[model samples]
Target chain A: MSIGKVGARKLMASFAIFLIATGFGMARYEIKDTPPNLSRFESTIASGGKTELSGIVVDEPDEREKNTRLIVETDNVKILVYAQHYPEFEYGDELSVSGKLKKPENFSGDFDWAGYLAKDDIYYEMLYPKINLVARGKGSWVKRQMFALKAKYLSALSKVIPEPYAAFMGGLTVGAKRAIGKNLLEDFRKTGIIHIVVLSGYNISLVADTVMRAVSFLPTVFATSLGVLGIILFAVMTGASATVVRASLMSLLVVLARTTGRVYEITWALFLTGFFMVLHNPKILRFDAGFQLSFLATFAIIFLAPRIEEKLHFIPKKFQFREIFSATLATQIFVLPLLLYKMGMFSVVSVPVNLLVLIFVPATMLFGFITGAVGMFSALLSVPLGWISFAFLRYELGVVETFAKLPFASFNVSNFPLWLTLAVYILYGFLIYKLNRRNTRKNQVA
Target chain B: MSQKRMAILLAGFIGGVLLRSFLNLGWAFAGFFVFYLSFR
Candidate 1:
C-alpha cells in the first residue's frame, strides 16, 4: 500500500528525529573520545615556571576597567590570558606571552569555571602575562574588522556620554566587552535585568523588527533580503557569540518563511535551530548557559505568553501593557527554576523591576544607537540624543539600584537542586498540555 | 506509524537530548531505549 500525504509527512518527521538523535549521540561520543592536543603545553603548565609561548589572539579581548581578558591560541589548544589594559591588544594581535600556565579552577561558588571555558576549547589560563607584540593582523579578516568597528563605536559613545552611562550604552548597542563595574553589575543581577546588557535574543529580534518595518515600503523580496542582511550584520558586529548566532538563525528562518509565503511554525523553527546548533557543537548543549537561557526564554514567550495573557483580563491593555506583562511573566516563570538552580539568587522584585525598566529598553537602545552612530561623526551633534539615552539609562539604573537595595529584593537559594528544577519544568509541561486540551475542546463545542 | 505514535517518538527524541544535556549519557540512552522499544 502506498503511504498517503499525511503518512509521508509523519514518516519524514520520524526520519528527522532519528537523524537528530543519532547526531547528538555521535557528537557526544566524539567529544568524549577526542582530546585537545595540549601535549606541547602540558609540560609547561606542570613545571610551574615562567614559560614563553607565542600565539595569535583568536578572539576579541574582553576589556574591563582595570584589565583585559584574551583567548590566545597556540599548539592547537586555546589559552585564556589575563592581560593589563595598558598597551592594549587587538583581536588579531600576534604576541609572545611569558607567564606561568595554570589550569582553570572552579571558584568558590557552584560555577564550573573550567567546564565553562572548556566548552570553548580553552583548557589553560595565564594570569597577568607579560605580553610582547610580535605581529598584528591574524585570524579572520571579517572578525578583525567587526572588532575594530565595535571599538570605534564604543570610543565615540564614551566621547559623547559620561562613564557608566557610556559603558551601559555600549552594552546596549553592541554587547560591549567592557565591564559596567562590579557593584552595578550586581545591581543588574539582583534586579533581574542583566539580559538587557548581554545582547540577548530580545535585542536581536528588536533590531530585526525595526529593520523589517523600515524596509517594508520596498518590494517583498527586497525587504525580506534587507531584513536578513541587517540581522547578519548585527550578529557579526556583536562578535557573533553563541546567543547572537542562535537568535540570528531564528530571525533568519522567520524571514525565510515570510518571503516564501509559508506559515511560520515557531515551535518547529526553534527546535530545528536548536538541534542544528547542538549538532554543530555538542559541548554547548550541556555547558553553555547562554544557549540554555536563550532557548528557554524564547520557548516560554511563544508557548506560555498567550495563556498568561488570557488570565490577565483585569490588567489594562493600554500601551500593549497586558501583552508585555504576560510575556515578561511567562518568561520569568519559565526561567525561574533554571536561574535558581544555576545562579541561586532569585530576584523577588524581578517582575516589578522588569516591568518598570523593560518598557524603556527599546527606546533606550534606539537613542543609544543614534547617539553612538552620530557621535562617530560629531560628538557635539550627538549631545541631544546622548541626553535622551542618558536619561533612560539613568532611570533604568536607578530602578535596579533601588530595588536591589531593598532587604527583600532577592533571595539566595544556593542549594537549589537539579532534580527540583526538572520537576518544576515537568509540572509546567503538564499544565500547558491540560490547558491546550481544554482550549481544543472549547473550540470544538463552539 | 500513526500520528500519535509519530508525536510520541519525536517527544522521546527531544527528551533524550534533554537528558543527555542535563543529566548524563546513561539516562539519555535509557530514555532512547524505552522510546525505541515503544516504536518497535
Candidate 2:
C-alpha cells in the first residue's frame, strides 16, 4: 500500500493534467453581464447598511457587530442593499429587491457574485430569479421519502430509548441538529467536537457499521448492500450536502477497493471527488466557503493528522489517558491551521478544552438522539426526554461559558499574512514527510 | 514513477496553477498546493 517516489511522481502528473483541463473548462464559462437596471436579493440588501429595498422588514440592530453588508436581487440584476433596516428573510424565499445598482467592494474574483454567496453556494442561481430550495432539485422526492422513513424509525426507536439521549443520538447519528440547543452547539465548537454534530463520514460509518452488525446473519452481499442502502437513506435524510456526498463517495470507494482486493489511492479518491463536484457545478469552485472549508479540513485531517499521531505513539498503547491525549493533539494540529484561516482565531486552550468536552459529546449526542426519537412517538416520551435534553443542554452551556471565559481561550489571527500561513503549511508538510517516512521504515522491520 | 501517474500529477499541478492565474482565482494556487502535497 506504500506509494513509492516513482508512483507518486506519476500520480502527481496525472492530477496536474486533470486540474488544468477542469480549470480551463471552468474559466471558459462566460458570466452574465450586469443589466443597467439590476436588483439584488433582499437578504443581500439587509446585510448592507441600507434601507428601502423591497421586501425588507427592518429588525433591531445589535451595536456590537459592525461592517455587515447585504445585497438584494431584483429585476434580473443584483444590487448592493445596505443593512441599516433589514428584515427577516427565510432562505429560498424569492424577493424582488429594487435598488440602485453598484459594484460592491472586496468581492473581486472569477466567480460572479462571490461576495454575496460566500456562505451560500448560490452563485449559479444569480442567473435565474428564484433560488432552488433544495440541492440538485432532482432528489426532492427521494429526500422526502427518506425523511418520512427517518421520522418513522425514530418514532419507533423512542419507545425503547430514554428521553434526550434519543434526540442527541439522532443528531449524532443522522446529522439532524435541529433539536440541539445553541448552548450545546457552543460547547461542541469550543471542544472541537462540532464535527460530531455534523454528519460527517465518521458518523455515517458508525451508523453503517451498526446496521451491518445487526444484519451479519445475512449473506455478505445482502448485508453490505443493506448497509449501503441504509447509509444512502441516512445521507438523504441529512440533506445530502456536498461534504456528506464527498464522504459517502470516499467510503464507497474504500469499500469497493477492498472488495476488489485492489489498493485504491486515497489521493485519487479525493481528486475524483472534487472533480465530480466541480463538474456538477463549476460555480461551487468559485463560491461556497463552507464547501471549501469542509473539503480543506477533511484534507488536513487525512493528510496531516496521521503524521501528528505517529509522533505521539511513544506512550504505551494501553494507557487510556495517553491515547486520548494523542488523538486530540493529532486532530487539533491539523484542524488548527484551517480553523484559524476560516475563523480568524487561534484557540489557545482548544486542546485541553476539547479534551474535556470530548468526554461529554458522545453521551450528550446519544441522549439527544434518544430524546428526539422519543418525542416523535408520543408526548409520553417527549416529557421525559425534554428534561434529559434540558439537563445536557445546561451542562453543555456551562462548559462553553467556562471555556469561553478563560483568560486566553482564543485570540485573533486576522492580522497574520497569507504568506506566513502558507509558509507554516509548507513547514508542516516537510515535518510530516520526515516523520511518516521514519515511521514507515520502523513498521517495515517490525 | 509510472508514466501515467507522473503525467496525471504534473498536469493537475501545472494546469491548476495556470488556470488560477488566468482566471484570477488566487485560491486555485492553494488548491494546487493541496493537490501537490496530497497527491505527491
Candidate 3:
C-alpha cells in the first residue's frame, strides 16, 4: 500500500525519533560513567592483565556449550567470562576464575564486533577462564523455573523421537542449542532452511500466525485484540527475547491493519516497536544478527506477501499451503540478500526445501507444544501426540539431509562486501516504492 | 505487460520456482523476472 503524505510524515518523524534515541543510548551505554566498585577492575585487573576473580554466573552461557561466554558478577563489577563448554554451568552458579581480562577487539575490514559488544556495556573478555562452581540455584526464581520447565519439555520430545530428530524438535520448540550436532547443523546451514530450527522471527511469525488464524472467526475487534495479547504472552513465555518481541509486534501490526484497514498503521507499528526494542537495549539493533534478520523478514512479509499471494492464485487454497508458500517466499526474498552479505552462501535448494519443510512447521509446533504441555501432566496422552510430532520432524530432517547431500545445493561467495549489500537493499527499496505507487494507483482506478 | 500477459507470466514464474528448482535455471530466471515486473 502507498503511504500517503500524512503517513510519510509519520514515518519521517519516527525515523528521527529512532535516530535521536539510539544516539543517546549509544553514548549512555558505551561511555556511561562506570560504578565506583568497578574502578578496581578498570585500574588493576583490567589493565594489569591476568588475575584471579571469584564471581557468580549471572546468566546462561551465550551460546551452545562450546566456547560459551558467561556473564559473571564479582563485587558489583560484571565481566564477560569465557570458558570451554564443560562442567555444564547454569545461571546463578558461583564461580572463581583466573584469566586475562582483555578488552574486546574488532577485526579489520569487517563489522566492528567490539563496538557491537560495547553496546551491551560489556568491555572486558576473559577467554578460557578457570571456573570453579561454588554454588548453584543462586539466580532469579522465575528464570530458574523457566529453565527447569524448558528442560522438562525438551526431555519429553527426546523421549519420543530419535537423535537428530529430537534435536530438531528441541530447536523448533525452544531456541536452537547444541541439540543438533555439528554435522547436522552444517547440513542445515548448507541447505539454508535452518530458520525453522533457529528460533528466528520466521518461527515466531508462524506461531503468531497460527494464533491469529485460530481466533480469526471471532469478531474482528476481539480477534485482533486477542491475537495481539496472545502473541505478547507467547513472547514472554519464550523469555521475552528481543527477537520474539519484534516478531510478535510485527504480526500484531498486520492483525491491527486487517481490522482497521489503515495499511499505513503498519509502518507506524513497525517503527514504534522497533524503537522501543532499541531503546530497551540499544545493542540488539547493532549486534544481534537474529534481531536484524527478524526485523527485515517481518517487514518483507508485511509488504510483499500480499503481492506474492495475489500472484499465487494457482496453488489450491487447501490447508492454507498457498498462503504459507507465499509467506516463505516473501521472507526468503527479503532475507536472501542479507544472508548472502553475512554468511556468503546461496542455496539453490533453499526455496523448495523450505516449502517442503515449512508447510509442516505449524502442525509440528502445535503437536510439539501440546505434547510438551500434556507430558507435564499425563504421559499417556502426550505419547501419541509426541509420535505425531516426531513423524513431521523426521520428514523435515529427511528433506535437509537429502538436499544437503548435493554438492550444488549451495555455493559460497568469499565475503560478499557490505557495500554491495547496501547497494542491493537500496535498489530493493526503490522497487518496492514503485510497486507501492503502482498498487495505489490501481486501487484508486478500481 | 497487459493484464492477460501478466497473468500468464506470473503463472510461468511460480511454476519455475516450484517445479524447475532441480537445476535452478528457471528458478533464477523467474526471480529476476519477478523483480523486473515488481518495479516495471
Compare the candidates by lDDT and give the number of the best one: 1
TM-score, candidate 1, first chain: 0.92
Score candidate 3 by DockQ: 0.02
Better of 1 and 2 by TM-score: 1
lDDT of 3 by residue, A26-130 (tens): 343333323335566667664678789888876656565367778888776677887777777877788889978877677755567765565456667888877
**Considering every candidate listed, which one attains the maximal DockQ?**
1
Worst 10 residues of 2 chain A by lDDT: A55-64
Interface RMSD of each: 4.9, 6.2, 19.9
The DockQ score of candidate 2 comes to 0.19
Cα displacement (Å) at residue A333, model 3: 2.2
* Top-scoring candidate (TM-score): 1
TM-score for chain B of each model, two decimals: 0.58, 0.51, 0.46
lDDT of 2 by residue, A1-446 (tens): 56698788755656666766645543532231112432344455457533333322111111112322333333434333344323433222344543333334445332335443432322212111221221211224565466665666556545545544454455566665345555555555654556666665555555555555676678778866776776677667776767777777776666667557889888678777776765555445545444555666566656666665566767555535455566567666765665675556677776776566555655565565566566666757566665665566556556656887776666667745646666877787788778778888989999
| Per-prediction DockQ | 0.24, 0.19, 0.02
Docking model 1 quality class: acceptable
**In model 3, what is the error at residue A63, expressed in angstroms?**
5.8
Residue B27 local lDDT, model 1: 62
